[model samples]
Target: MKNRNVILTGAGTVIPWGAPSTDKLTDILRQDSIFINDKGEPIGEYLYSLLKTQMGKRRAYNTPNFESILHFIELLFEYKKSRYSMSSSFFRINDFFLIDPEIQNKLEIYESQKLDKRLDTSFGTKRLIANEYYYYELYLHFTFLIKKEIEKYETVEEKYHELNKSFNRFLHQVKGENGIVRFYTLNYDYLVPKISNLKFFDGYDEKTGKMNVKKIIEDDYIDCYYHLHGSFKLNFIGEKSNDYSVCYVQKNFVQNNLIPSNIITGYNKPERILNETFYEFYQKMIEDLIKANKIYIIGYSFNDMHVNAALKRALKKGSAKITVVDKCSLEDFHLKYDKIIDSNPDYDMNKLIKFPNTYQMTTEALKAKAYLNGLNDFLDNLIRSNN
Candidate 1:
């Protein structure tokens, strides 16, 4: 049976209130005071308070440093759980965290030192005592030294949460045969999974290497999350000795030992199919989406050439209809198309083979229209008819 599908896109299309318009997003991104503390103080003031409390001294706190990075990460995770998960089915996005190069290099140095073997009990104790100061020093170095410029109107966390909720609703409303709904995101954040509470089927048996899909029964909502860009919580094989080891950026420091390269920041494209496990799973997601009756896109711009190529390949073989939900106009879509066509003339633009059966709608107009149009009823009927 054909499954009804909807895709929402924008900076924060899933927020309960609705995805902010492009103008609103632009304004928010431009503001410096957007990052606020729990008590509604500016981030700078909050950092000063924290430093005074910790160091017992009053000093000029630096902006664009590790302090802000840690604050941003903490605030991001905190907000996701609170504001984004009221009624969404699941939230998952591609790579969310982009680690800085300086931080990556430091982590690499620490990892190289611990390479040969697991530290013995005695060595572990001594190493902690010896490097405790250095660890904190490294923490401060990154926190105080690294500078991150705020985007003119972007609150990455806020937008992410908003979009997550919207997408969840869209997916949750899907009802039909046991057809699959797949999300492929270029983002590296965990907002989607966190907001939707969907588990990423990593295809591993806890007891064995045999891979399997975590099944969902009929009438169950289990949308597949494929992170084409990786994730913040992802860990490399053999990176940590114990399965229970928790890795997180506590305050400003990574609490667990992890190499910098594993963090997946910088401009580096992830190695294609790093392992057998990931390759099979990724291939399956692409295949499933291609075979589905409909494909909905939200938030992603299809800017990456590699991803665009993959989509083209999938469309060539699939009969699925494509709906691209973005904040762009028909003119904007044409401009993007012209650019793509210019670069890849071999792509059949005349036949519409690559982009035929595609639809585009502005996010703001869609929301207002959805309200007036009673989207829930429409979606329910669509699902029923399609199935």
Candidate 2:
């Protein structure tokens, strides 16, 4: 039980690999080759204008966050999806609005004859558009920015050789000891896999790339790496309803060479996990928290209440110890998480969130307790003592 070590990583973990922060992403997007919509409108300018209008004149300078902008796009897409789904003879659906212009021209002769009429003026159904194509162009740019940054790892940057080498050594040592470290990451970058020398498994089949969470959960101890948030190669595939017997529903996650995307960023992530693809991963996070003997929370902001609540419950048990691997000082950590810890009568935040006491601190004395290098030492020492 003493050797039960669990690690949770967040967005900051991949910063070393030239991964862009939310603000940095926005900055780069503003200057990068801008994506133009069908109307020859730049995607960023179009979206930013909408975003600026939403914020009102006083807050015009307030740049849009990844969450808010993505949420806005998602809401619009959902509205269009549902709005057109309503069956009615009275309404002429905008289905043809997104059709290829040449194709629309080809079908012009039969426009009135067709029940799903093309929205061209000659047919009496006005060619009204909703900037629907812009939604995809915006999302494509978002995905492109993130993917481009992470792909920088493909080049052997001389500056980070030592860091990657150190990471490999730690992973190799753990592999030699036959101990598994369950890495649950909220980041979508493939940085961890790029440097891992130990055997790795992420439930995606080596030959096919099909992910089966049920199979992953079964092989728990040794081969465990869960993406708590969606990743770059993951995409929504198909829907499966448990309504087979009025029981359950399932949705498929898909990916292809052309559109190797679908990472959950932007607003309402806590609410987004309710979907089938991400739900099981989050459920396992709580179980891992309860089971952990020593938990290492690394580079996380604690902005997610679902994650925070799990940490609170795990600490309330008064058995497991937690060490955050951030540069946040003890007092500041309390100020950041006091509301979450305050509600639980059983929690003594002072005990779990304290100075490293020993000289085992990794980053700074006043900031955070324990880190990867120190953690490797702890596990190695424990293995030696047991032998």
Candidate 3:
């Protein structure tokens, strides 16, 4: 028996209160304020206070840097509400040639300057991109706040706190078994590492609290975490400023050369799958999933084509049974599993599938097994005494 457990969790498993779906985030953008909860109370007061504490206790209302950041978030939220009002899914027109005429007019010179379409004239594609950037930027901001708040928990007992405890406990379990847990997150925030209290290593040394992959694999004692798309922590490129430090937060500064990491959204994700860093993490996740005896997925919507493709490949390559833990209906979950099964002609259903309810049954079986084993031992002793 492969007595090892490998868990793959999405943003839902991390964020306590927020619905872990992109549609739910769109609902927040449609709200009056991102800070206000569904009850209309400013639930974001704590977030504001934390930022204020970091920026300066004395900085007056609406300073240029402070106000600008808030304005960017507001603009993004409003834009998503306006653009995605009628559509169930957001669309990003990434085709440079299919850009809006107005944007093309402004960048006509750069458009003319490009010698070839393959020469990477991305400046012209800015207008083609959707309003989703604001939504993502706002998300990163909120996630950072959430991470800071969760870190304050010395002992968690609340329902919301359970998510953090679950992650912490799961990581420790994997470590105890001398197993490596690879986290490939779609989130731009550093919440997983912050919550797991692990180091960030992306196979290179940029001195940004990151480590090398060689050291990670050679050492059986350490767990590895990777940002599949990218992260805001890698925003400043090679700036080497410990942005997590309170001093950096107080400065409210962003470098001029800040690339802000590559955040993929909507249908443009597949294009990023080939990126050097992104591919590295994605390949490693597939490799681990194929090697695992059992895989537990929490809060991940099996929606992304690129991710689903990798998952299907991994399922076909290995004999691992999967348990999806989420609020989706059994039929909905089975529909996703069916797609994976269809990929393999000789798929064995009995050995490859399970659900959340099955997990409960397994726990019960363990208790029953213990009792039965004890009863058998007692019966043997009684028979020996009778003889």
Judged by lDDT, which candidate is best?
2
Candidate 1 vs candidate 2, TM-score winner:
2
RMSD of 1: 15.7
**Per-model TM-score versus the true fold:** 0.42, 0.64, 0.50
The local distance difference test score of model 3 is 0.43
Model 2 TM-score relative to the real fold: 0.64
- Order the candidate numbers by TM-score, best to worst: 2, 3, 1
| Top TM-score hit | 2
Candidate ordering by lDDT (highest first): 2, 3, 1
Per-residue accuracy of model 3 over 3-110 as CA lDDT, tens digit each: 444566665454443323443343233332433433443323322333344446445443222223333343334434553442213322212122234433422332
Off by over 4 Å in 3: 1-5, 15-21, 31-163, 174-176, 197-206, 209-221, 236-260, 343-387
lDDT for model 1, on a 0 to 1 scale?
Answer: 0.37
The TM-score that candidate 1 achieves is: 0.42
Q: Cα RMSD (Å) between model 3 and the true structure?
A: 15.7
Clash pairs, candidate 2, are 67-266, 67-267, 235-254, 237-252, 240-250, 242-248, 242-249
lDDT (0-100) at residue 130 of candidate 3?
A: 28
Residue 274, candidate 3: Cα error in Å is: 2.3
Please give, for residues 169-265, the per-residue lDDT of candidate 1 as tens digits.
5566542345445555554334455566445443334465333445411222345554554433334331212231333321212222222211232
- CA lDDT, candidate 3, residue 295: 66
